[model samples]
Target: MTSISIRSNIQTEIREFLKLAIPLASAQVAQATTGFVDAVMMGWLGQEVLAAGGLATMIFMAMMMTGIGIISGVSPLVAEAYGAKQNRRVGQITRQGLWIALLLAIPGMMIIANLDGLMHQFGQAENIVTLADTYLNVMAWGLFPAIAFAVLRGCIVSLSEARPVMFIVVTATGFNIIGNYVLAFGKLGFPEMGIAGLAVASICAHWIMFLSLLGYMVWHKALRQYSLFKTLHRLEPKTMQQLLWVGGPIGITTLLEYGLFTTLTFFMGALGTPVLAAHQIVLQTLTVIYMVPLAMSYAATVRVGQWFGQRDWQQVRQAAFVSIGLAVMFLIVAAIALFTHSRQIIGLYLNLNDPANANVLNIGVSLMTVAAFGQVLDGVQRTANGVLQGLQDTRIPMLLGTFSYWGVGLTTSYFLGFHTDLAGTGIWLGSYIGIATAAIAFIWRFRGILSKKESRHPINGLTFKE
Candidate 1:
């Protein structure tokens, strides 16, 4: 092709990626706002409460990602089926996904409810453990609803109907804020429940998001034709197996990444309350910014899945490259902002002037400074993982993630934090290496996949065979 043609194609690809990515990214930010809302509101309660809440939130997210990984199978399946014009198959996959969500929730609730023993085993302080236990016990009930919402979201997002999800998420953010205020502080005729109240608000928000999205899917003109609700009670072994095949690795991958951070939380907790609190603040801030690349990855999965379904290898590669480029560019900007204004950002989460909070504030600023270097790599790895998911190639990525995060990241963190004087800073530095390793591996894997000849046969009803 001529230079003009190549330039035009690049522009078109960028536009396509942005069209899907922008709304999805906004929705992700809105979803992340729940955590931000909890962190900030809990911060108002006190650093101890904030630390406990943050620890509980990280554990909750770790479990939540498991169910999310399982249900994520819906995206590529629905996207490919939709692209292939197999409307009935799309509906079947979604219905089965709900079953998977419900099944996962049972054990999830149990695990969360019984986290008290586990936290103690990890050497967490009794006070923080008590508060975290209270938080998890109440928040556990929300797991099923949250997983259900994720399933529906996967279907909607794969079909490229992300705006409604964004709308509901924005609405839920408002409800969460109101609910947190009234319940956590004894306003609106409710008893003040402290950290537990925050958990309750999160549960309420999850249910609202689930119900709203379900209602929209039922009523939406374009979506009604798929009849996602028609076979909700039925279970297909083949469909379930397919979902597991794709989703199990995704779950493992999520665990690999989340487990690393969760383990770091434990390490921070071991250091003391101030260090733990600082870690939470920096983590929450980075998570919010991380949503941009996360959303782009989701978009990549949808776009690549659809293009693969249509046997358009060129467009699939185009979508992958474009997504990676956008993720890198966005994260570069975020890294700059974080690096330049570390104290300013931490100040938003803590009262820097308060003597009690000074240590937490200083530690948080330092962590954020270290975090700035990793943001770009984090984006790249997350985007590459998303593209691979779209291509329906997950097992290798899972292996890579395991090695990078656990073998390289955690081992380094332990040696640095415990065996050396770097302490929390050492842990953060180790995370940088782990994430960069995963990013490099994923990008290499994706490029290799793109360079190979395209096969005509479909892989798992989603991707083309290698």
Candidate 2:
């Protein structure tokens, strides 16, 4: 291809990526915005309330990501099937996904319902443990809808119809925030429910999002042709097994990554409420930044899977590389913005003018600086993993991810946070190495797979088995 033609093709690919990525990112942003709303409202309650709420949120995230990661396998499967014009197979895959979502909800709810003892085991104060337990107890009720929402979302986004997902989620998030303010603050003659009210708002928000997407699937002319709800009770043992095989590693990897943050929260909880509250502020900011690339990765997963399904190896490579490049560039700029706006961003989550918040704000600024310096690699790892998911190449990536996060990141976090004076900041700095390591390993793995394909080599070296 001529240089001009190559540039045009690259530009075309970028536009395609952003078209899918932006809406997915918007949905994620809306979702994370609800977290921001919760954080700010918790801040209004008190430092201890904020601290307990933050811990509860992290644990909920860990549970939620585990289920979502597993269901995410359906996205690539649906993309490949749809791209190959197998509409019936797409329906089957989605049905299996919903079944998996329902099954996951059972154990997940049980765990969330009984976390009070676990909080006590962590040596948290009685009040903090009680508040966190109250939050999780209510949030457990929303877990199934959230998981089902992930399945429906993946199917739609795979079909390149992410706008509805974004619209429904944004609308639901608006409902969630409004509900939070009115119920938590007793704004409408409703008794203030505090943290429990926030959880109730989250529950209603997820149900709204779930039902909206489900309704769209039922009523929308284009999607209705797939008969997604037909045979909803049918069992597809092989398909469910495939999803589990491909997605089990994904769930474990998700657990590992979120598990890191959850553990860090425990460390912060031990340090005191001020440190925990500050950690929540910076972590929430980082989540907003991370959601952009995370959404881009999911978009790349759909695109690359479609290309792979069509047996277009070169297009697959192009789509993935463009996504990685876009994500990294965005995060590099985001890191700069975080560096400059550390105080202002923290101010959004906590009270800056209050003398009571001074220590939390100061800790938050320091943690924000640490995050700003380290988050670029996060983009690289997420997009690279997305490529692997597209190829159904997740098992080895899981191992590499576990080693990087636990072996390198969590280990360093513990030693640096407790064994030295660097404290919480050192813990944050260690994550940079972990993210970079995963980026290098995952990128290396994908490059190897691509090289094998480009060279017309045997498929024996494929990262995962069929």
Q: What is the TM-score of each candidate against the true structure?
A: 0.97, 0.97
Tens-digit lDDT string for candidate 1 (276-359): 999999999899999889999999999998987786777888889899999998888899999999988888788888898888
lDDT of 2 by residue, 104-205 (tens): 999999998898888888878899999999999999999999999999999999999999999998999999999999988888899999999999999999
* Runs with alpha carbons beyond 4 Å of true place in candidate 2: 457-466
Write down the lDDT of every candidate, Cα atoms only.
Answer: 0.89, 0.90
lDDT of 2 at 118: 82
Model 1 residue 450 lDDT score: 64
Over all chains combined, what TM-score does candidate 1 have? 0.97
How many clashes does the backbone of model 1 have? 0
